[model samples]
Target: MTILIPAMTQAENHPVSLTDDRGKTIELAQPATRPAAISTFGADVSVALGRQPVAITTFGLQGVPAYLGPEMEKIPSLGPRHQPNLEQLSRIAPDLVFAIRRYTEKDGPQIEAIAPMVAMDLITLQDSLDAVALAGDALGRPQQAREINQRFKARLDSLAARSPGNRTVAILTSGGETPFVYYDHFLTASLLERLHFDNVGGSPPNPESGIPLGYRISLEALLALNPDVILLLPSNRQRGFTVNPVWPYLQAVKNDQVFEVGQHWKESAGPIARSLVLDDIERLLLPDDTPLKTSSR
Candidate 1:
């Protein structure tokens, strides 16, 4: 890869100043104590750093992450991550705000009016690592963030070393007749690819947004791909595709390789979520081996 990011092993008294994913310099007099998380990554990183956000965006239908424990539920919710309740957020009066670039870009000025928003690009594996570092610095826990990243990298290397031979795989979502197949650049897909799983969706044609991270596929199209394994990240439990005549004929379905994974597989940019993802992969794919525990969990 590129140059290894130097560890910020100690907290600094100097003003916390860093460029965000939006390429804007966010400077704080000290460090943020009461931060509002408009993105789940923000909430995820904050909790991992031993600090709870004053308020946080919802984590799908599950509300605050259950993995983060029940205490998170007590924290005020800003509704949905994409369109958080700005009025509610302003009332909380947080000192800083962590947000997703794509989701909050339009509301950047509005968010900044209340508190300085550090918009993060939480798409790829590298983005996740960078966001953790940025959040660590912002929250005055740079060292913890650095350690988290190091542990994550180590885990990836370990998983890659143990991954089975280049088996073609696909991360599919939606329970409907037409499933949305993830491109390799998506966080979970990237993790799988790192473990030597060849992603059938490869990369998207339009690189800028990766907007439609997954392309909706017909049963005919899925059959043409016929991946060896299918990791089903359903939006809900109702799987309409299972009843189709073509479903049973697929290689993964016939061989009993169609595994239904949790929401962590979808929103997997944060340290805790990603670590849990590694656990799931190990449990699902490397079942015979004993699960190795790590500080990340």
Candidate 2:
């Protein structure tokens, strides 16, 4: 028997319609059954809401811990995290297509022709959490979404309780000559703040200095910050052991405080993925001797 569900409004007054990245109003006839997510974070939200999207961008998981599990590896790869295969996406004929703001703004009209597209604004960690909850509400999984949120908050609180002292960190997208640092609304900064860590410096020096949502950075500026801990994004162009090269001589690098985290965690913000990120952050901030508090979930 086929089950039919009606389209649910975002909030009591918000309604069931949303603007695509290109500013087109797309109305949902019903909750999406076959969803297509353009970003890795969007894919995580789809999975968290109990709908495995037919297509999804790829994820990087080189150094993630074991508890996060192997969920990402199981999904069908559409293409690189930021650059998705439009032709492949079109073939899927998804009921709903969720994409990042930039992706939708640039390609929404093209994607909308294939399916109803909704551009999600998920620049910050809080935004990511809210997106998950919103997706869950839309998909009728409010309880599951709430549980995920609680789990993340509990882990973050535990980490904060352990380290009352704040450590100043600088998150950079390492590449080129001048690495770009993420600011307040960026995903990495939001994640670090949730863990009770302070990000050094405020905003980019210039408006043009800000890297687009999913771009890489250089090493020269990274050395200048001399952050307490360094998170490295894996290099697709480099085949072998490509170290930070110059930055390794810096204080943070010399102390072996540099960690290689997955691009997905740093780049994407979703309930399940963010939960995994919070877990990794907990491992990074707290000692192994620190016991896990019983989760409120």
Per-candidate TM equals 0.91, 0.75
**Tens digits of per-residue lDDT for model 1, 1-297:** 121223553345547777887678877876788989997788888899987899999967767768777888899999998889999999999989999889997888999999998888788898899888888888888788999999999989887766764588988888687888899889999898887789998797776765668788888788898999999884755777778899989999999998988777888888999999999988887646534434332
Model 1 is weakest, by summed lDDT over 10 consecutive residues, at 1-10
Best by lDDT: 1
Clashing residue pairs in candidate 2 (N, C-alpha, C atoms within 3 angstroms): 173-217, 175-217, 175-218, 179-218
Cα lDDT of candidate 2 equals: 0.62
Worst 10 residues of 2 by lDDT: 1-10
Candidate 2 TM-score, C-alpha based: 0.75
Give the count of colliding residue pairs in each prediction: 0, 4
